[model samples]
Target: MQIDLAMLFLTELQVGSERLYKIKRKGTSLNLRYEIDGEIHRRSYLSGLSWRAILLFALTEGKAVTVHEMDQPGRYRKLFPNTLLRRLHWYARPNANFPPVARFYDPNGKAVMLLTRSRVCGHAVDALHNLAHSGPVFQPLWISDIMALRPMLGLDLVRDETFSAAMPISAYLEAAAMMGRIVEEPEFPGLSLTGNPRRLVTPPSSKAGRSIFDQASRENPALEKLRDRTIYADYSLTI
Candidate 1:
């Protein structure tokens, strides 16, 4: 990969950019982890901007990639020409479910997004949501998924949010790093890349990057802001 392309991918992904919030009521508190996850999933799936970044990187590199719409069609506009992509059947989503994802496969490897529904669209789908994204399993899953691909390019075309959502993650990275697959590119200052099927890490510039200080990502509601001088949006625990 071109150094600039890699650097651009790292920067554009904005690994540590998400500013999360916690809410406190006058007396009771609200549980928004699932809600937060919903919002995150909704954005990740519906937002064309996110997919554009991923596809753009691959197209720029002239790498052949596939995006499984998972039966949802016309959701992601074609970023490149017809010859570049091989799409599966595009299906309709009548109810418009939350956490719908398109599976991505590129020369680097694939990111298998598990949703509530089965591959063939089973009833009462099983969800990969609600499981702690930053918890024990999710972060390591990224490394394992990439490793299994054994990509030809020594990279994994992962989105920036993958790094962010799984923030404060490292043990798996150290393992990948041990293989000399992970390192910082001198060409791009502050770039920390874990290659051999890349292990996504928050670059130094990310606001949510490794830090000792406590960081708050958002503001409390106007009502809550007025009532309690002490109350601020609590950082979400599950998110």
Candidate 2:
């Protein structure tokens, strides 16, 4: 059977909640790890397409389904009925009240997933971070704004991007800038920074790259200020 590779990876996950995964690079290998059923599972990839397919699968399936039980090789197609797929597609459309599934790289150049929620309620970032060894990043401004407006509308929200259009360019810039800063630092202790360092690295000149300097300037105006801080203070160098 022709398998949609994207659907296969995601359905293999142990957990069902919509969460992000981090892909690390070790020399020529891509190291992937995420929490499934509260246990950590790791795999290695040699191709970018393979890694992307894994992530796509996770987002599409949102739960684990064994291959033997599936009719199609692709987990996503097997798990999602036609009706659910249509609903997911409709909700995922640009204007729907769903969080867009976005990919980004950390300073160390690892591939990461950014997920948005439908409701304004608080999410468990620590849980997500623990699953991937990289902490989850929250877009609080967007979440807060959505929470404020949710009471006024009678919409059954599944994600908060419904009002993303109402957000200004500045808001997006600020969110991008914050992500840049967070990706540089090694906040999680379980994950190792040493490896091939290129297999899962971020783009050299993206929003995360720009935030390196911007964050440094704001946190440490003078280079002298960082002297007493932790070695990981400068996110650009460590990640």
Candidate 2 lDDT over 1-239, as tens digits, reads 01112111112111113221222223343334544335565555443335434433443356442212111133223322344334433432222223333222223333233332221111101001111222332221112111111122211123212222332222322343334423322232333434211212111222322344345346546633332332111112212
Q: State the lDDT of candidate 1 residue by residue for 66-144, as single tens digits.
A: 4322211322223111221221112112222222222222334332322212211111111121122231111201111
Error of 1 at 45 (Å): 10
Q: What count of clashes does model 1 give?
A: 5
Q: List the residue pairs that clash in candidate 1.
A: 22-234, 71-91, 116-125, 116-126, 181-195
Model 1 — which ten-residue stretch has the worst lDDT? 228-237
lDDT of 1: 0.23
Best model per lDDT? 2
